[model samples]
Target: MSNFAESRADLESYISARVPLISIRSIEQDRALRLVREMAANPRRGNLPLWIYTRATGTRDLRTNAPTSDDRSWPGAMDFAATQFANRPQSTVVFVDPDDLSDDNSASRHVAELARLADANAGSIILITDNPLWSGLQRLGMSITLSLPDASEMYDVIHAFLTDHRGVVPIEWNEQDARRAAEFLVGVPEGTAINVLATIVTKGSVQRDDVEHLARFKDKHFGDLAGLERVEVAPDSQQVGGMTSLRAWLDRKHQLMKSDLRGTKLRPPRGVLLVGVPGCGKSLSAKAIAGQWRLPLYRLDLAAMLGQYVGQSEGRLREALDAADRIAPCVLWIDEIEKGLAGQNDSTGVGRRLVGQFLYWLQESRSRVFVVATSNDVRSLPPELLRKGRFDELFFVDLPDSDDRQEIIQLYYQRYVQREPTAELLDKLVGLSDGFAGSDIESALHDVGAELHLNAGAELRPEFVVEAFANTMPLSRTNPEQIDEIRTWGRERAVPAGRPPTSTMSGPQHAGRRVVVLSD
Candidate 1:
């Protein structure tokens, strides 16, 4: 007897009396059958019957252990039901192969014929298939849904099936482990789920993320871009630095997703688009976020995805997205997105369609894969991406403010220097490095250190370091106009990565953020 109940006494009572139809989808046949039995009372004198859609040829029926043969199509399924009822006079059950219900003309004919017989015989019908061809039959009758089993219920459902069918899965499935397994399998395709379950039973164990459990992506990488601290960082990651707003947002989102099985049935925003000058912490942020989440990081290199073959690039992109989804709770970092997607076009709307496909997946995907993409230029980014739900936020990383410069200098000095430097000397270094990109400061330091080492027989010296600074020409001077333009863009559009303390900074327009410059 099926222990699971499908509905309340009232609903079950109603379904048992009438020729009720139920539609169940996904890898839960046992649960679906249990639902049917619960909704059914004692078999009717002339009409009580059941039908199942399966592709497996019955070499031996499980309950009877009788050798059964001859695959039956959907229409034949009705005949089988009628025949069984005529002989047994109890509830006659017929199994129909879902593969029989294709969209081909023959398939439609079979479905129509089955509907006719079902109406005439006063028999009950249940369509259990994934996006089945008989979905159109819904228009004829009010179809009730058998909701997908929740994570908590999946183990019980699977165990029930195995006890009677698979002869595997231990009887006592721990609640915690079962919950984890259910969560891990959520959103996986049906074929993969079955294979995984079968492997676990037959082989004694199956490691997660194996080729047998491959989600859908192949191996690939996008090009590595230089610099992360650019003012125009990722759109969603922009207006950052405070961490207050973003932290709260992330916590909430994480809770919502976890309640649905760690994003197995939930989603956040699409991906990110980082735009700005080089040398900020944009790349660092990408890595840091993944580290914080304890998720694997995959870098997608577009250049590697590109190929001489037509559609190769698009294919690689699709593969990468699938892989990310399968290995979800992971991060896919696409550095310098504009360089690859900016100019590519195809006659059949390949590029456009690819972008649309990506957006569509982003909109509908329930996987936990988080995408972090960076770009140096935003002028040509498709407008569709700027839509509200695309990403969480946008950030612009400009030159380090004095306070940030001090922090950066301190970080590097402590990293490279054996002992702490004098505070007075550090302040002077921070001042002279003003208006300079983080990388420029590094370059300046490197040049000075190199000269000092060379002149003093590679021995570190304070005077030599001072002399190198005097001789070095900061990129700030050579690229003044460009820097200003970037800073202008950073304006209010960007957030501070290293905001000055309230006591040290003023209320200037650009006081807390990376600067933005006018195009002219």
Candidate 2:
């Protein structure tokens, strides 16, 4: 059942069973109030009388907004409620977010006393709060938590809004469009969904394109980002050198990400693990995935999650993971994941605990959070994380080979020089850039482009590009042993990111077994 329906049923049962103290935890106060009001009106619960007490409106009848009491204060309402529970049977009193409930304050103590009086008379006292009630007060009754609406609930809310405003506004959205828009609006509150639709209705027309803007609309509500850093991808930043295998894999997964898997057993595609050389396109591929899939990119900075106190790091990690789940259908990039989770011998057990917590969320969470985790030091990663099913697949991205380097050269050549490189110049540059990472090639071309731009009216020369390449040193050349170690580790375990070189391509092919990527 949806969270809303399940919570409603729980509330009804509590009221029917004469539960004296009932605590509801929810951020949507209005929705919770409406739920209580609706349950009270039902005949199964004998149409019980519900008295709602809000700070703004002291005490009022749930059926009508008319005040049931003259005094408009919390103490006065409590006094009136105590009197009713003492005399009347099956009375339901709801308090809307009264202050001083965090601990055993006077207000909580009074509520606890009132709850015992209600218990004797078989009446129910309901407390609607955004925060958790004190353990002493909460123990007096059962608590039900109402989460944000699911996809099905979102669809109803969106479709209802559109139906209500059909003639008022020009709407070009069909049923499918509404359903698609509802999927995007899944993690938002019901009122926020309506507000977003209203904002769109304010515009002249609600075209089919407006459905795609719903995610950006919901993004505005979560501006703080908690522990995540929003990584913006520009149009030009989407290009990657050459990971034909990874690109093709992501292309297939992108469709699954956008598809509606409501009635099926299939889950959306989990993310991939990119463990390869530094400066090679591991991190860049994260951005490229976000750009290609048209989903917002968020970087989970592990450094920000650490804390000096006990259990602080684990708490922070949970908050970050929960935040990611709330912002679903987005790419979560954890760059150099090993640095954060590779502690095997630390004196404190925080590192091991963090690893366990992360693995639990990754394996069990059904949210559409595509995790693109890259690591330069794979040896330090926990063995359990490397086991099957932790990630969909672990991909090894090595330095660009001759064919990959040629593609990288052409990509940067057009971007910086504003023209394609000649075939002869490309071959020579490709050979010269042997063993260079993708970033190294880009750096060399960027320098050449900057110099050319500074010297206005100067002609673009191949010699200038060659000279720029000559002056640079790549990491692979500086640390050959480290590169070899990474390559040897990946050679047997992970799938190669680049496609197999053909006979026509003139370069030494890296040795690895090619695994075929299958479609569901």
Candidate 3:
């Protein structure tokens, strides 16, 4: 059976059993009310009259669509509901936006009394709201949360929307694109999905390239949520300098990562945890993965999710996760993950709870939100976070080796100097940049470019770069003890990002070698 069918069945069973109070938490009021009408019309349900009460529409008959009374205020509505149940037993009264009961003490008492009266009179009072309010009703009623449309329902929604606008606007999606769009629309409401589709096709025909438009639309949907920021990804052709091993891993999973995965046992890759020394391209890898895979990137700020009120933090976390799920097939990057989650020993235990929630979602979330978390201090991280299943792999991004340094130097040289480096210049810069992080290499090269620019278009020379390197102090030299600790941890626990260092020209013998000034 479909998910909605199963939920409707559950609702029918509850109403048939004459559950005095039924609380449904949902934002889709029309769909929720439709389910109530269907349940009321069930042949076995004895034709129970359906009465819906809203602030604007006081009381209306579901079948006839006619207003029964004009007492629209909260207190007035409660009194009217009590009168309806007492006058006619076994009627279903749905109170829309019943959260107002929590704000008024008299209304709360009135609802509680009405629930008790309905229980005795064989009638039901259903409370419908998006949030779970009125804790006082917990003892008197049962609540069922109606989730947003699932994949199958969303697919139907999209298909129906397309069919409705078939000739009005040009549509160019095949079955596969429709299925992919449905997956992207999983966490979004059906109404919003329709609106987004309408907005997209409103401009012109929606071709395959318009799939990116849907991603941008989903990003807007998540913009209002706290603790999550959407990051724009560069094109897939943008190359990341090093981390050969990590890049190779991504290449292997590239096919499955892009596939829809309908009939295969191959699950999409979860993501990786990059823990390493500072300025070693850990966070850069996170952004690069999104570009490499052609997916959007969103950064989750865990510390920003903490709220002053109880449950608010968890709610915000859930909102962020849901937003990620909605924008699936995207990269979720959490930089410096340890700083956000290392407070497990706090007095209030909020940290512990947050850790539990995050770990649970990390393991159980089926959405294709590939998480790439970077951490500089794994020592502060909880032990459970390092377990194998939390991430597909844990990589150690140490300082760049000789070959990686060469590639990084060349990349930045072309970027900053707008000219290619000669063989001798590349080799000398690589030698001098030994034990330097990727950022350190870029800094020195950037300084060289700035100095050259100041010299009024002077010809680029290797000496300028060498001088810049001499003036710079790499992180390895400044914090030797911490770097040593990180390298030691990585040696045992994590896989190296680049291949092991070779003995050709990376040693100290070449460190001080002066570049030969070859005349061009």
Candidate 4:
């Protein structure tokens, strides 16, 4: 059913044909054996069955060459090899030592032995090795590289291995359960993951519960993203909101990264940057994007990532990215896009180089991981991150106007009401909370609850909420030019998140209402 299996099946059909050599790679050797058998029995009429001239370099004597440690015995391999060789005496045979091939004497001796075998067998010969063997294989002219396990085939091989060799009870231990668990914890430590899985499934019967346990395991049991990833400047985007256009752009990126995609129709977006005001919803939007896309999120913390020690930060970042890729289809949320890697040209070249490496991986990668980067300042970003194809689109989440304000307020009020909020009151609160960002609205809502608690008679009503809202200073006013500069920078180069408008501002300020913004 998988691409690898389908591909391997096709490859099997060519095993005995004019194909120079065939290579089957997988950690699941049992399933690989099954594939060899099926390939050897291709049903094509008037066509010869597949024949593999597998030859070994180890001692050929039955007693001396016998394997000592594992069931993958030389005897077993020899038996299999003999069976095939007997069936096709003139089949091509390739032999390369698994050990050192650098010593000219050893190399020449091995090559001579393979040549003798090929002559006696009346078949072509090839060599496989790391360095010296490369020359040997090349001298032979016809050879194939042993490819690593493919993802699609990997699960099947593993499941088959579990069933065949590990006393797997198919009814008790199904392939679906094993595959699902493996997919869920792909990056978990091998030992820990196995133990956790054993504990879950053995909870004794149906595989459904085991799957749920994997789903609910918290950050502590599983590896922590904060501990695993790096960060950079692109001011965080969680606070940003009302970016309908931006969300749409990311949605397209999601489709591009779908697992079902294949063969060139699937081109994922390179990356995306969030341009927004200081206290706007840019950071919040990035976090919400994870929820929207139904993906795991890894926040890259540059401050936590960079180390005073040489080469450490970069090494850590590489490991982090590897982890992300191994757990593909996750969201990488990088906060404070500007400051995170802006100093690359000067004293921070090492840090800049690290960002360069990240960008490099970003460009060449073909996985489903989505990158959501938020920034308050754009001038600090490297030219590379801003390069034409780097991101799908650059969205600017400016300050909230009337409609957005209403959404923010309605969200907070509905959250507090523990039910739906009154529509009229929602509109009034939205107007009273003009200029207040999502964060500011949340703060004001909290303040209103505090105000209600401080006074026994007054319930936390819209009027009191407006009073609470009026008491706080919006971040735009609190930090004057800081937020404005951000907005100005994004004027045209960036797409707007859509404004809620200022005419709503013409109405009288709410009675006893005060606007406020929280400060660091």
Q: Tell me, by TM-score, which candidate is best.
A: 2
In order, the Cα lDDT scores of the candidates are: 0.53, 0.88, 0.82, 0.57
Q: What is the lDDT of candidate 4?
A: 0.57
Clashes of each: 34, 0, 0, 40
Query: What lDDT score is found at residue 441 in candidate 4?
Result: 83
Highest-scoring model, lDDT: 2
Local accuracy of candidate 2 as per-residue lDDT tens digits, 96-189: 9987787988988999999999999999998899898889998898999998898888888988888898889889998888877877787888
- What TM-scores do the predictions have? 0.56, 0.93, 0.83, 0.62
**Residue by residue across 1-520, what tens digits does model 3's lDDT show?**
5566776888888898889889887889877776777777788865687788887888888678798766677777777788878988897888888746654366677788898999888999988888765678777878777888887788889898888888887889987788878877777777899888888887877788776567767777766555678777665325778888888988887666667786666677788999998998888887888887667788999988888998888888888887777678689999998877886577777777888889988888877889999999999998999998888899999888888898898888888787888998888888888889989988988888887789975777678778787778998999999999999999799988887655675556744767899998
**Which residue runs of candidate 1 sit more than 4 Å off their true CA positions?**
1-47, 51-82, 85-119, 124-185, 189-274, 298-328, 332-334, 337-371, 382-384, 387-390, 409-432, 439-478, 500-520
Give a tens-digit lDDT track for model 1, residues 140-243.
44444444443345555454444554334344444444444555554443334555666556755433333222222211121222211112223333222322
Per-residue CA lDDT of model 4 for 81-193, tens digit only, reads: 44444455545332333334445566455544454444454433333343434344344333333333333444554465455434343234565555554555544444445
| Clashes in predicted model 3 | 0
What's the ranking of the predictions by lDDT, best on top?
2, 3, 4, 1
Model 3 is weakest, by summed lDDT over 10 consecutive residues, at 502-511
RMSD, one per candidate, in order: 10.5, 4.5, 8.7, 11.1
Q: What does the lDDT read for residue 513 in candidate 1?
A: 75
